[model samples]
Target: MNTSTHYPNAPVAQPVARHTLAVIVDNEPGVLARIAGLFSGRGYNIESLTVSETEHDKHISRITVVTSGTAHIIDQIKAHLDRLVPVHRVVDLTLQGEALERELALVKVVGKGEHRVEAMRLASAFGARTLDASLTSFVFELTGSTEEIERFIKLMTAVGLTEVSRTGIAAMSRGPDAM
Candidate 1:
């Protein structure tokens, strides 16, 4: 072991920050693959990814991605994505002023008696709707911010949270301008 002295002047790593990116691209084959390839090739991890064709006539699709990295790395990702042939625009929603973000989650809980009552009570408090219910299980539909969904899930774990399915974040700037 080459024991080296620690240097006080060494550079400190920047804090990793999570950001949401709204990518508009041509609704064609291989476009999504290219974007995925870019992230995978760079060894970047995406926390959440949502894609849908927003403009059917214009053949444009919107891709919402949540990722974490240092500020410089985030900037690099935006720049690289802008260069893709099919991509029309890449907007960092988090950096953009006052973006509204929301996610939809379907939470399933299995229980009986008080567990059932408690689940319903919690869901009602969280504004979650009962989508499906049976003799021993129930599926609740909740739409809220990611943090809220997480909190709800955490609380449900003690009651009877069996599974969860989330529709990744969908975000937009508060202004009227299109992204």
Candidate 2:
């Protein structure tokens, strides 16, 4: 006689990691909704998402999604996404070495006198362009990494930031490979 115990149902916790995924899909109505639905339905959170038609003739679009999850969850997300009929390819840009990522922001600042001068000077140091300016307010256009944009916004807030509009991150892998 022998006595043995087994606990196969035990769960193991894994550290969460942030990933940037580039998905290529058919450019058609409802595609973006479907992708969003998949994430929502699965209870996954999207930190940032950007989509645009990349190849007009090919009728293909690219979606860049930033999400954080355990390794297992990330793998499952990719697998499920690849199984979607309209999905062409899913590339994990985060795991694919260094990639280029950028975001664009339109910042509007309202100030007078010294505040206005400081705002413009800081903007110049950050390489921000003056898109529109009036006696009391100025609208600047900035393009850079997310961190850079955030830092600029923070600095502007102290001066007189009034409004801001941002285009979510758009990223791609570096080198000769194409996605």
Candidate 3:
């Protein structure tokens, strides 16, 4: 005798995908807070967020938010954002084909003698510029993809890495279209 069991009404789980969403809104006080509140209230995680006024004359600001979730969750997030009073537009850059994303980081390393030399060498290899230098410490500025910055910081650990500050990812679609 052979037996098999199956549930006909079982729900299938969708795979989670990372998405980069660009949001356009009025450049006014409390706009950022409202956006953040939306994510916090919904329990959605924001991996990276960057916001700045894109159109000074028009008083429009662009927010780049990197997040991960199932397709349904992403859709819900976008829909909720659209309902917000200040939101003008929301674009999923990840699904919009080719896009360019970059971040800036400032890394400080404290070293002496050979350690300092090694830090300089590694910075040069990573195309980082020395923004400040003293007898015992050096501050390097680097701009690149998130992974590149992480790798550079990891490598610097062996050369007396001390502190770091990073600007979250800024992304935009390629070609002539404006977001």
Each candidate's TM vs. the true structure? 0.92, 0.92, 0.95
Predicted candidate 3 versus true structure: per-residue lDDT over 1-179, tens digit per residue: 44353766567899999999999999999999999999999999999999999999999999999999999999999999999999999999999996799999999999999999999999999999999999999999999999999999999999999999999999999999876
List, in order, the clash count of every candidate structure: 0, 0, 0
Which TM-score value belongs to model 3? 0.95
Candidate 1 is scored at a TM of 0.92
> Runs in model 1 with CA error above 4 Å?
1-12
Note the Cα lDDT for every prediction shown.
0.94, 0.95, 0.95
| Structural RMSD, model 3 | 1.8
Q: Is candidate 1 or 2 superior in TM-score?
A: 1
Sliding window of 10 residues with minimal summed lDDT for model 3? 1-10
Q: At residue 43, what lDDT does model 1 achieve? A: 92
Candidate 1 per-residue C-alpha lDDT over 1-179 given as tens digits, one digit per residue, 9 for 90 to 100 = 34354775677789999999999999999998999999999999989999999999999999999999999999999999999999999999998876899999999999999999999999999999999999999999999999999999999999999999999999999987877
Name the regions of candidate 2 deviating beyond 4 angstroms: 1-12
